[model samples]
Target: MANKTLVPQAKAGLNKFKMEAAKEVGVNLTDGYNGDLTSRQNGSVGGQMVKKMVEQYENNL
Candidate 1:
Protein backbone atom coordinates (compact mmCIF):
# COMPACT_ATOMS: atom_id res chain seq x y z
CA MET A 1 0.00 0.00 0.00
CA ALA A 2 1.15 3.49 -0.78
CA ASN A 3 1.28 6.04 2.00
CA LYS A 4 -0.83 9.09 1.29
CA THR A 5 -0.06 12.27 3.19
CA LEU A 6 -2.69 14.95 3.41
CA VAL A 7 -1.83 18.57 2.76
CA PRO A 8 -3.59 21.90 2.37
CA GLN A 9 -4.29 22.59 -1.28
CA ALA A 10 -3.89 26.36 -1.00
CA LYS A 11 -1.47 27.45 1.67
CA ALA A 12 -1.60 31.16 0.81
CA GLY A 13 -5.30 31.20 0.11
CA LEU A 14 -6.36 31.98 3.66
CA ASN A 15 -4.72 33.19 6.88
CA LYS A 16 -5.12 32.04 10.47
CA PHE A 17 -7.73 34.65 11.28
CA LYS A 18 -9.71 33.74 8.19
CA MET A 19 -9.55 30.07 9.05
CA GLU A 20 -10.73 30.76 12.57
CA ALA A 21 -13.55 32.93 11.28
CA ALA A 22 -14.60 30.15 8.93
CA LYS A 23 -14.82 27.79 11.89
CA GLU A 24 -16.90 30.29 13.84
CA VAL A 25 -19.32 30.35 10.93
CA GLY A 26 -19.42 26.52 10.79
CA VAL A 27 -17.19 25.86 7.78
CA ASN A 28 -15.41 22.53 7.74
CA LEU A 29 -11.86 23.65 7.12
CA THR A 30 -9.37 21.02 8.11
CA ASP A 31 -5.62 21.17 7.75
CA GLY A 32 -5.59 18.79 4.79
CA TYR A 33 -9.22 18.84 3.76
CA ASN A 34 -11.18 21.96 2.87
CA GLY A 35 -13.76 19.91 1.00
CA ASP A 36 -15.40 21.69 -1.98
CA LEU A 37 -15.22 25.34 -1.03
CA THR A 38 -14.21 27.63 -3.88
CA SER A 39 -11.57 30.31 -3.40
CA ARG A 40 -14.02 33.18 -3.79
CA GLN A 41 -16.56 31.70 -1.37
CA ASN A 42 -13.91 31.06 1.24
CA GLY A 43 -12.54 34.57 0.86
CA SER A 44 -15.97 36.13 1.08
CA VAL A 45 -16.88 34.32 4.29
CA GLY A 46 -13.69 35.46 6.00
CA GLY A 47 -13.81 38.98 4.55
CA GLN A 48 -17.40 39.51 5.53
CA MET A 49 -16.71 38.34 9.06
CA VAL A 50 -13.78 40.71 9.40
CA LYS A 51 -15.83 43.60 8.06
CA LYS A 52 -18.60 42.92 10.51
CA MET A 53 -16.18 42.60 13.40
CA VAL A 54 -14.46 45.87 12.51
CA GLU A 55 -17.75 47.68 12.28
CA GLN A 56 -18.82 46.38 15.66
CA TYR A 57 -15.52 47.31 17.22
CA GLU A 58 -15.65 50.82 15.80
CA ASN A 59 -19.20 51.29 17.03
CA ASN A 60 -18.06 50.57 20.58
CA LEU A 61 -15.20 53.05 20.36
Candidate 2:
Protein backbone atom coordinates (compact mmCIF):
# COMPACT_ATOMS: atom_id res chain seq x y z
CA MET A 1 0.00 0.00 0.00
CA ALA A 2 1.05 3.53 -0.64
CA ASN A 3 0.48 6.57 1.54
CA LYS A 4 -1.23 9.57 0.14
CA THR A 5 -0.43 13.14 1.10
CA LEU A 6 -2.85 16.03 1.22
CA VAL A 7 -1.94 19.33 -0.38
CA PRO A 8 -3.03 22.77 0.64
CA GLN A 9 -5.10 24.82 -1.74
CA ALA A 10 -6.32 28.39 -1.81
CA LYS A 11 -10.06 28.46 -1.70
CA ALA A 12 -12.64 31.20 -1.63
CA GLY A 13 -11.36 32.39 1.73
CA LEU A 14 -7.85 32.50 3.05
CA ASN A 15 -6.69 30.64 6.09
CA LYS A 16 -5.80 33.88 7.80
CA PHE A 17 -4.91 32.12 11.01
CA LYS A 18 -2.28 29.87 9.42
CA MET A 19 -0.67 32.76 7.52
CA GLU A 20 -0.38 34.85 10.67
CA ALA A 21 1.12 31.94 12.58
CA ALA A 22 3.74 31.30 9.90
CA LYS A 23 4.76 34.93 10.13
CA GLU A 24 5.18 34.74 13.87
CA VAL A 25 7.42 31.66 13.59
CA GLY A 26 9.45 33.03 10.66
CA VAL A 27 8.26 30.51 8.11
CA ASN A 28 8.15 31.86 4.56
CA LEU A 29 4.83 30.66 3.18
CA THR A 30 4.76 32.97 0.20
CA ASP A 31 4.94 30.33 -2.52
CA GLY A 32 2.80 27.44 -3.75
CA TYR A 33 5.18 24.57 -2.98
CA ASN A 34 4.49 24.39 0.74
CA GLY A 35 3.91 20.65 0.47
CA ASP A 36 7.63 20.29 0.91
CA LEU A 37 7.06 21.19 4.53
CA THR A 38 6.97 18.21 6.86
CA SER A 39 3.80 17.59 8.79
CA ARG A 40 5.40 18.75 12.00
CA GLN A 41 6.60 22.01 10.51
CA ASN A 42 3.31 22.77 8.89
CA GLY A 43 1.42 21.91 12.07
CA SER A 44 3.63 24.07 14.22
CA VAL A 45 3.05 27.16 12.11
CA GLY A 46 -0.68 26.51 11.94
CA GLY A 47 -1.01 25.72 15.62
CA GLN A 48 0.86 28.82 16.75
CA MET A 49 -1.20 30.97 14.44
CA VAL A 50 -4.48 29.65 15.77
CA LYS A 51 -3.28 30.14 19.32
CA LYS A 52 -2.38 33.77 18.74
CA MET A 53 -5.60 34.56 16.97
CA VAL A 54 -7.64 33.00 19.74
CA GLU A 55 -5.76 34.98 22.34
CA GLN A 56 -6.50 38.20 20.51
CA TYR A 57 -10.17 37.36 20.17
CA GLU A 58 -10.39 36.53 23.82
CA ASN A 59 -8.74 39.78 24.83
CA ASN A 60 -11.24 41.73 22.78
CA LEU A 61 -14.17 40.04 24.47
Candidate 3:
Protein backbone atom coordinates (compact mmCIF):
# COMPACT_ATOMS: atom_id res chain seq x y z
CA MET A 1 0.00 0.00 0.00
CA ALA A 2 2.82 2.40 0.74
CA ASN A 3 4.40 2.16 -2.71
CA LYS A 4 1.12 2.71 -4.57
CA THR A 5 0.97 6.45 -3.89
CA LEU A 6 3.49 9.23 -3.28
CA VAL A 7 1.47 11.43 -0.97
CA PRO A 8 0.29 10.19 2.40
CA GLN A 9 -2.67 11.32 4.49
CA ALA A 10 -0.34 13.08 6.90
CA LYS A 11 0.39 15.74 4.25
CA ALA A 12 -2.25 18.05 5.67
CA GLY A 13 -0.91 17.69 9.17
CA LEU A 14 2.60 18.48 7.97
CA ASN A 15 1.38 21.51 6.08
CA LYS A 16 -0.40 22.81 9.15
CA PHE A 17 2.68 22.25 11.25
CA LYS A 18 4.79 24.08 8.64
CA MET A 19 2.47 27.06 8.72
CA GLU A 20 2.58 27.16 12.50
CA ALA A 21 6.36 26.97 12.50
CA ALA A 22 6.57 29.72 9.89
CA LYS A 23 4.29 31.91 11.99
CA GLU A 24 6.38 31.31 15.09
CA VAL A 25 9.48 32.45 13.15
CA GLY A 26 7.71 35.45 11.62
CA VAL A 27 7.61 33.99 8.11
CA ASN A 28 4.58 34.45 5.93
CA LEU A 29 3.30 31.32 4.18
CA THR A 30 0.30 30.82 2.00
CA ASP A 31 -1.99 27.80 1.69
CA GLY A 32 -1.17 26.91 -1.91
CA TYR A 33 2.24 28.10 -3.09
CA ASN A 34 5.27 29.79 -1.46
CA GLY A 35 7.80 30.49 -4.21
CA ASP A 36 8.15 34.13 -3.20
CA LEU A 37 10.02 33.33 0.01
CA THR A 38 13.79 33.71 0.08
CA SER A 39 16.27 30.96 0.93
CA ARG A 40 16.79 32.17 4.48
CA GLN A 41 13.08 32.52 5.14
CA ASN A 42 12.30 29.04 3.81
CA GLY A 43 15.30 27.60 5.65
CA SER A 44 14.20 29.21 8.89
CA VAL A 45 10.75 27.65 8.62
CA GLY A 46 12.24 24.17 8.10
CA GLY A 47 14.72 24.70 10.94
CA GLN A 48 11.99 25.77 13.30
CA MET A 49 9.92 22.69 12.42
CA VAL A 50 12.84 20.36 13.12
CA LYS A 51 13.59 22.16 16.38
CA LYS A 52 10.03 21.76 17.57
CA MET A 53 9.97 18.10 16.55
CA VAL A 54 13.16 17.41 18.49
CA GLU A 55 11.78 19.17 21.53
CA GLN A 56 8.62 17.15 21.35
CA TYR A 57 10.57 13.91 21.10
CA GLU A 58 12.71 14.86 24.12
CA ASN A 59 9.64 15.76 26.15
CA ASN A 60 8.18 12.33 25.41
CA LEU A 61 11.25 10.61 26.77
The candidate that achieves the highest lDDT relative to the unseen native structure: 3
lDDT of 3 by residue, 1-61 (tens): 4534256887888889999999999999999788999999999999999999999999999
Model 2, residue pairs in steric clash:
none
* Per-residue C-alpha lDDT of model 2 across residues 1-61, encoded as one tens digit per residue: 6643244464313456566678888777764678777788787897896787689899999
TM-score of 2: 0.58
Provide the overall lDDT of each model, using Cα atoms, as 2-decimal numbers.
0.70, 0.71, 0.92
Clashes of 2: 0
TM-score of 1: 0.45
By descending lDDT, how would the candidates be arranged? 3, 2, 1
| Error at 13, model 3, angstroms | 0.4
- Candidate 2: minimum summed lDDT over ten consecutive residues — where? 4-13
Clashing residue pairs, candidate 1?
none
Model 1 misplaced regions, further than 4 Å: 1-34
* lDDT value, candidate 3, whole model: 0.92
Q: Give the worst 10-residue stretch by lDDT in candidate 1.
A: 3-12
lDDT of 3 at 54: 100
- CA RMSD, predictions in order: 9.9, 5.9, 4.0
